[model samples]
Every structure is written in structure tokens, then in C-alpha cells.
Target: MELQFLGSGDAFGSGGRFNTCFYVRDARGAFLIDCGASSMIAIRKFGIDPNTIRAVLITHLHGDHFGGLPFFILDAQLVSRRTAPLIIAGPPGLRDRLTTAMETFFPGSTRVERRFVSEIRELEPRCTHDVEGIAVTPFVVKHPCGAPPFALRLTVDGKTLCYSGDTEWVDGLRDAATGADLFIAETYFFDKQVRFHLDYATLARHLPELGVKRVVLTHMNPGMLARVAETGCEAAEDGMVLTV
Candidate 1:
């Protein structure tokens, strides 16, 4: 299995990083963890074919995390002429939220017919859902996004990958990342405690307890970006790829 950081920045694109998007490819197929608003551009720039993505697993309803679906669907319909099924799995009310976002942006885009089938699956928190042979479990996290935010644990090709999607220091993270091959976490700051966001210092304090094989920090703001090297943890960079 291979993991690629397509966009590793915070919501504001701090340090010139793109929004939060990660591409995961296994023997079965390729899928995305979060399709941020800047994902389409980042995908194209990185020479990745959008059609190769079989599914998209969303963590929350925030624009930076879930806003690119509309554009991706439109592009697949109009430009790529894609006809394969695309699975978009997320928290409850995903279908409704995407429809609302589509209409708000394109004003009747949801009404347009498309060549491909867009499958929307509302994931039950703490329950494992299978997406095209990949197993994904969403664990509720502490974030106020008008809905329950999730930290995902994905199992594919005999490997596990965990993502701490935008949240403060939460005990649930230990369970989410336990025995995983990679733990992609959000370290928005170096040491300063912020509301609804994780800081590097707190994460470092609990690193041994998490017990993951590897930990890479993402969703960094300017402050975190500046001190990434000092944190002594691998920091994700846009376009960086890792194999496990």
C-alpha cells in the first residue's frame, strides 16, 4: 500500500500548502481520504488521474475538507467523460449536505444528469463500512462542524492507516491509531493550545501511548509549519508519497 499527500495544509493554505487531501493506493484500487477544495488542482498538478480514484472518504462537512466533491463530479462528467461508479462515503447527512453545497455553488447542478453513478454512503460513527473492498471505520472526534467530525481508521491490503481529522486532543485517537501502519495527525500549532485543534506538544506527550508504527503530522498552520523540523516528527508535505 502507498499513501500520498496531495494537499497537507490547513484551511487557510498556510505555508503555501494546499488543503487537506491524501491519496491512498493499494492492490485493489486508489481512493482519497479527504477531498479538499484544492484537491482537483493538486491532483492534476501531481499528474494523478482523477478517474483512478474509486472512492472518497470524507471526515467532516467543512469546505476545506468536503467542498471539492461538486467540482470533481462536474469534471468527471464534462471533461473526463467518466462512467465508472464513484463512491463518496462520509458521516450521516452526507448526501443532503453535498446536494446543498452543489446547489449553492452551481445553482441547479444537482439536477444535471451525469454519465457516471455517484454513490453516497452515510457512514455510522464507530462502525466499519466497506468501500470497494477497503474497510473504513469512522470514530467521532471533538470538532464543531455543524455535524460530528470523524477520525478514520482504514484497513486495506492487510495494512491499516489512521487519520486524526481536525480535532483537539481526544482519547479516542489512541484507539483510532492503535496498531496502525501510519497515523496521519493534525498538528496545527507547535505548543500553543487552541480550541478544536491539536498542538504538537500535546500529541508528542501521547505519542508512545498511540503505539503506531509511523506518525506523520499534517494540517499545519504557519506556526506549526515553521517548527515542523523541531517537532521531531515526520511532517507531511504536498506531493510527498510514502509506501508501507
Candidate 2:
């Protein structure tokens, strides 16, 4: 399996990095972990064909997490002229949130007739679901984003990948990363303990307990980015790719 960091910045675009988006591909299919507000721009900048993506797994409804769906869908309809079906899996009320976001961005966009089909699957917390042949398990995390935030564990082609999507030090993270080939976690700060975000120091202290084979930290602020070398884990940067 191949994992690509489309964007690895925090909500503020710290260090001029783009927002959070991870592209995962394997023999089964290709999918995006999170489509942040800058995701479409990053996809184009990185020379990725949007039509090749089969599904997008969203962790929460935050703008920096799942805000680019409208642009992506419109691009698929107008630019790519794509006819392949796209699945968007997220927490409950996904359809409503997406519609609201679309309308907020472009008036009447959600009602427009489209060439491709966009399917929204509302994922129940702690339930494993099949998304375009990939098995995905979402565990509810500590972030409060108007809905149940999740840390996702995905299994595709016999490989497992976990993502700790913008959460603090929660026990659910262990469940999300346990026995995974790669764990992409959000280390937003170096050592400062902020609410609803992870710190590198806290993660480092508990890394052994997580039991993941490899750890890559993403969604970093400027302070965390500067101190990444000291964290003893790979720091994810935009356009970086990893094969697992």
C-alpha cells in the first residue's frame, strides 16, 4: 500500500503547509483520508488525478478536515468529466453537513445536476464498514466538532493503516493504532498541552504503549514542525509518499 501526504498542516496553515489530507492507494483502490479546505488545490499541485480516487473517509466536520468536498465534487463534474461513483464516508449527519457546506460555498450547488454520483455514507462510531472494498473502523475521539469525531483504522489488501485525526491524548487512539503497519497521528504542538489536539511530548511518552509498527506525525504547528527531528518519528510533509 502507498500513502501520500497531500497536506500536513494544522487548521491555521502553519509553516505555509496545506491542510490535512492523506492519499492512500493499493490494489483494491485509491481513497483520501481527509479532504481539508485546501485539498483540491493540493491535489492539483501534486499532479494527482481526482477521478482516480474512489472514496474519501472523513474524520470530522471541521473545515480543515472535510471542507473541500464541494470543490472536489464540482471539479469532478466540470473539469474531470468523471462518471465514476465516489463514496464519502463520515460521521452521522454527513449528508446534511455536506449540503450545508456546498450551499454556503456556492449557492444552489448542492441542487445542481451532476455527471458523477456522490454517495454519502454516515459512519456509526466504533462500527466497521466497507468503503469501496476497504474495511474501515472509526473510533470516537475526544475532539468536539459539532459531531462525533473519529480516529480511523483502515485495512486494505492485507495492510492496516491508522489515523489519529486531530484528537488529544485519548485512549481510543490506542485502539486506532494498535497493530497497524503505519499510524499517522496529529502532533499539533511540541510540548504544550492544548485542548482537543495532541502534543508531541505526550505522544512520545506513550508511543511504546500504542504498539504500532511505524509512526508518522502530521497536522503540526510551526513549533511542532521545527522540533519534529527530536520526536523520534517521521514528520509528514506535503507531497511525501510512503510505501507500507
Residues 162-193, model 2: lDDT tens digits: 99998998889888888999999899999999
Clashes of 2: 0
- C-alpha TM-scores of all predictions: 0.98, 0.98
Lowest-scoring 10 consecutive residues by lDDT in candidate 2? 223-232
Reference-based lDDT, each prediction? 0.91, 0.92
Q: Where's the lowest-lDDT run of ten residues in candidate 1?
A: 169-178
Whole-model lDDT, candidate 1?
A: 0.91
Report the C-alpha displacement of residue 235, candidate 1, in angstroms: 0.7
RMSD of each: 0.8, 0.8
TM-score of 2: 0.98
Model 1, TM vs. native: 0.98
